[model samples]
Target: MPDDLREGRIVIVGASLAGLRAAETLREEGFTGSLTVIGDEPHPPYDRPPLSKQVLLGRMAADSAALPMRRDPDAEWRLGVRATGLDPVGKQVLLADGESVTYDRLLIATGTRARPWPNADEAALDGVFTLRTRDDAGRLTKRLAAGPRRVLVIGGGFTGSEIASACRERGIEVTLAERGPGPLVGALGGTLSMLAAGLQRAHGVDLRCGVTVTALRGNGRFTGADLSDGSRIDADVCVVAMGAVRNTEWLAEAGLAAGPRGVACDAGCRAFNMYGIVTDDVFVAGDAARFPHPLFEYQMLSLEHWGNAVTQAEVAAHNMVSPEPARRPHLAVPVFWSSQFGLNIKSVGVPTFSDQVVIAQGSLDERRLVAVYGYRGRITAAVTVDMAKWLEYYQGLIETAAPFPPGPGAADGRPLVAAFPVPSNVPDPKGLFHGPTVALTGHLPDRRLTVVRPAD
Candidate 1:
């Protein structure tokens, strides 16, 4: 490795969890380069998972969620400045403030933003909220603390489910609307989705599935909404938890394989140009990266999990400094967790990549079990509800490509559930309102494609 490569200028866009971690890793890896971290938010990088959990429950202040730095990266912090353009040929990042920062290597860590309500007029309503950034959490937290009559949460994803759980914990009236058959179906498949729906309803949540909000009713402030089923919800507050939009629009003309999905990259975290040629200088990590994994049939994965961001960032950073022969692949299995409705939910691998699921251990009726998901006949994913302790074991099985309907000794002589291998019931993303935590990219086997025939 050349000393010049080690001491060259490295710029990271998006001063987020991924960016901060990558910066720290670079310095730790003996890189004495001039580093610059850029962010659009005025505040420095902070933990976002808490925004939907402890911050909303009043267990912690929104402003107090700043991430603890492992060690100072000694980088130049360019806060509150948005990167408007990228010149790959010149290795320069154009800023919105008429400034351009040149870099020997660039890292794209621009994560995602909350998908707003479709209706701009209704979204501008005073009582409406979308939780993403610290400011968003603070504003929504204040609104939640005001003791509204009733709160309506649109979407049934993890964020929406957590918001509803918080409202219920506060003894507030809350209605949850999910356009899918049940909450979390798009992410965890049907077997667990049913359990999630039951959990929400049992906890006093006015759960409404298979329905969409047709209109948000308000003159100047959000008052209520009308559902597609011709039902009216008169609530004091409305929360749009529809999902997230990747921060890739700004890179449309950057000559990279960047789009609504994300920037396409290889397993080693090297970004691919629009022509599918991998670039050595440009890299991507966090929610903005769509990298291929060998386990899931080489399908590109877009993971929005915190663990992925940290691990992938470390890999990207290490590769940034290491020579070609010493570089490593970012092959860590996707993992995510959520605490809602008094239940700790954890998932491993890509559940949406599976076709069948089996109750390998515990019982759904007991609300404590591990659901193992399989594609064809091999283990692809596993989800545990209140059985997170066994997650590591399942993760090992997935890594080994263990056969579905895991054989004896899989659960330490504990009898597997009678409801063995069943359809995973993973639905189409377009049909669901909530965005999935781990999105399996490339051509999905379940999605229908119309064949256009030329005139004979």
Candidate 2:
């Protein structure tokens, strides 16, 4: 077996944001190794957040969303090539072009893809699009700029909401259909998400709550959408802003503990086998990894957030080159942001992990406040809208396992509630936009841990 990964070839899958950052981190850690980064997309590593925002709003071109290199790793880049299989025994990755990449260590950073609309025939319509890749954004942004009669945005999630915001900013009429009671009900719960619903409707969006898109009707181009509420919308353009789907299908036969959530990994980013045994050389990172976080009840979480992609990649890269004793675990708090309809929403922590929410600062009606999420008398997450300054204080509470609703000095000298009950029926995004592919399985994580060394 290879003694260490200081010199031998190291291959990385998913040459997107996380993949490029990991390569840079590998070099920064003083590892002079042969690195090969593979991506299914032709473009080099690019920033995805901007694709949904600036690119879609026509402020920036999608092709120009390439992320500035954090550090010069100078690794071999394999773009536009699909990874077909992984041969763990041979330490080789099978490429779709019938080529094999042998490696001493492997990093899986394949993040996720945009969940497309169901009903393949309907999805293939001209104006129907899903935003995920840079190319997808380029196409959608240009299409949105064409000034369609009415835009139909399916799903009230962040992506869909952002797209609707962009369309409204363009002065185009938009119809947002959500099966849930309110916008962002899946992530921010019913109480806060109701504010989002009001915000969208006030901005001239035909916000239809408690209705799902039944079908898309168009010959070759999108004409309109059929709703589950026995109503039809005349939509010339439709944007499916469903969440994400983890790109882990290529590892089906690798005998790794991978499922719909993602490849199971330890806090140290070490990939586990199908039998729940950890491997020494195979590591997982980015959105494709479902690892345990101490802050979230020690439950294995699969996050597709942008901050987690860079944080976890650096941790995986460092652990890949360092000795076991010198290695570290990735316990970074999950943080994410989305700008939509003139509101800047930021979240620190897993909002879904909480059972209750409270208004910590400002009022929801003012559209400038923070909601603290709690579960079982403990703070689990916090969401702020245009009030990000107070988020840091709440983030500290979450990290130290602070109590729910917070104590005195938690906010700006305001009274704190101890048992703030989050509205119990925060609709599941899967239930709202059932067609989007992003799914975080609601299963008790398999936390069975095992330590192993290379065979003699």
Candidate 3:
């Protein structure tokens, strides 16, 4: 006999956007069980995309940007309480208050947080921060309000680039340092990042590419940073947008498969233990779950995008209360977007997985076009800047596993160029993951086999 959906104790950890969505879906699926949500944050889940843009630009209040609930979930909201530990044998979650909540079924959506500067003495410096939570935005926003003389932003990824864009929009002087060759090389590619460098320079940004911030110097508060190219900038503030670290440390002894990458999960969102054995009652989602994807040779992907969180959460919730026959798979294409350097960049598929890329539409000269990436002889990813209307077309190509290096016809008669530049992997600023941020790492595919989407 299958478990009854009407009455099983369900506990959700992390209280993030994904956690909230799962709670709502559980109730919608007619699960009337005792439900409780545990979180380290004091407030409800809020939208995070705006933190780098609107919040920094003084356009939106940190609290006001929170996502509105579709309906009252009615679950016991354990706000501000952090989960200290997890005991799979007892099926209980240990809270900071020394309270334990037992559950027949559990969902882990812990997600990730910005990885701060490694040195404690350096991280403790004033005006140095990382953006992840609403509270983080609030503090940074207030600091930006003070109108610091100069801002030194480290890392040139989406978050860091967006912060620079906000500064430029505010007429604030900023110096951006990237360990990679250019701004978005870690995510997009060095080829496209060249254009990004151009955008920044056009807007009068002190964009320093292919250089690193070796050390942050300050007496007690942040005053300046030393660059790898033998240069120094005396700035009043510094923001470390060096990427994120998965928040799965508490699950170490929980007997689950958690590691530096993220928790390993199957297509149906069922969590795997340290030995790779799938669990029946435990599930995982969001940036903390590394599930395999067909587009990237089925290697597990750990994504920090907003769409992945919502989509993966729904899949986990549905599978939680449904029979095996009724369970669905999470096969959503990995996509992400960012607004920086006065350009709206949207990407579908994993660009870092490709060995070659071509400007399929618009024109690189104009800085408005879609670039298609290919691995071996198949389409792997697509990136668009300003010209986003054509992304849907290329997205269809990826969804259908279309041919590699999509023809100039993909341009839809925009214009033809002789050739375009392909990109190479550029590691993070901290030199943690030497691979590209959107890495193409995976098992070598059998050349004889064609790419196929996995079954649910």
Candidate 4:
């Protein structure tokens, strides 16, 4: 490693999980230069997964979810300040407070924010809320504890489902409205989502599928919501859990390949310029980065999973300090998990990228099973319900690109023939309000380019 690479100024844009981890890695890699981390929120880096689970359940406080740092990076912390824009040409980050910070190497770990309800006026209603940050969780937590008559949850995504579960556990009446066929269908596909829908209803959730909240009714405070199916829900509180939007708007004019989806980057975490050329100094990681992976046929993937963010941030930090020959690619497979309705659901690989699926083990009737997904006769992904112990076994199959309809005894040595394969039944992403945890950004053979061109 060259001394020049180790002693340059480095700036990280987001002070969340990925940004914190990347800063720690840069120090561990022996980069002794000046480091700066900027964040719009006033608080330090914190864990977010618990905001919807433990915090909402009253087991943990929102402020107590702070992420423990492995080792102090001894970097400048610019909290409560927003980065208005990026001057890639000038190698500076423009701040909202009429200031610019310069850096030799830049890391955009801005991540994502909760997608709020579209209508501004209705969203302003007192009881309408969207959970994303610690403040949001704190506010919602107090409301849930007040014991509303009925809580209205719009969208059937993981966050919404978890919120619904929390409401039920508190003995509060709640209604869930999903535009899709069932909850979690957009991510886990039709088979397992059916199981999710059943769980919600059995637990006393007013599960309404194939419906959208047409309008939110309120008079200074949330009164209820009108559904697309011509039905109205009268509740004191309404939570909009549609999905998340990547925080790439600040980089819009930076000449990077950034848009509503996210910033485009190479597998090595190098950011691409507007002209599709990779920039050596600018890099991306966390939910804001969309990078290609050879395991998924070189498709650009934008993952919102915690594991991906941690691993990718480390790779980005390492490559940022190492020579070209020593740099490594971020190829960690996507993984995500959620707990709702007394069930622990875990997934490995991109479940939405497959065409067919089969019950490799257990049975859905028992509410415990491993569903394997395949694309073009090769294993692509797998989801386990209360059977997470065997997740690594299926991950190996996916990594090997094992044949579909995995033979009996593929994972377990016991003689149990796998069930016949069936269509994974992944729905069109356009119809759902919730975004999948792992999103395949289409087939981009030449990831260097912004758009795929026809072969001559």
Candidate 4 per-residue lDDT, tens place, 1-456, comes to: 135899979999999999999999999999999999999999999999999999999999999998999999999999999999999878999999999999999999999999999999999999999999999999999999999999999889899999999999999999999899999999999999989999999999999999889999999999999999899999999999999999999998899999888899998999999988999999999999999987788888998889988999999999999989999989887889999988999999999989998887788789988999999888889999999999998888877778876778887764433457878899987788787777787666575543322212
Q: How far out, in Å, is residue 190 in model 3?
A: 1.5
Residue pairs that clash (backbone atoms under 3 angstroms), model 4: none
Judging by TM-score, tell me the better candidate of 1 and 3.
Answer: 1
Q: Please give, for residues 143-171, the per-residue lDDT of candidate 2 as tens digits.
A: 88888999998888888888889889889
Residues 120-166, candidate 3: write the lDDT tens digits. Answer: 89989998988888889999989988999999888778888899899
lDDT of 1 by residue, 1-456 (tens): 235557799999999999999999999999997999999998999999999999999999999988989999999999999999999988899999999999999999999999999989999999999989999999999998999999999999999999999999998899999999999999999999999999998999999999989999988999999999999999989999999999998897899999988999887898999988899989999999999887777778999999999999999999998889889889899999999988999999999999999898888789988899999888889999899999999999888888877875687686677546889999988878898887777842322232322112
Reference-based lDDT, residue 139, model 3: 96
The 10-residue segment of model 2 with minimum total lDDT is: 447-456
Report lDDT (Cα) of residue 172, candidate 3. 87
Which of candidates 2 and 4 is the stronger one according to TM-score?
4
Clashing pairs in 1: none
Quickly count the clashes in candidate 3: 0
Q: What is the lDDT of residue 50 in candidate 4?
A: 94
Q: Report every candidate's CA lDDT.
A: 0.91, 0.84, 0.82, 0.91
Q: Which ten residues in a row have the lowest lDDT in candidate 3?
A: 426-435
TM-score of each: 0.96, 0.94, 0.94, 0.96
Worst 10 residues of 1 by lDDT: 446-455
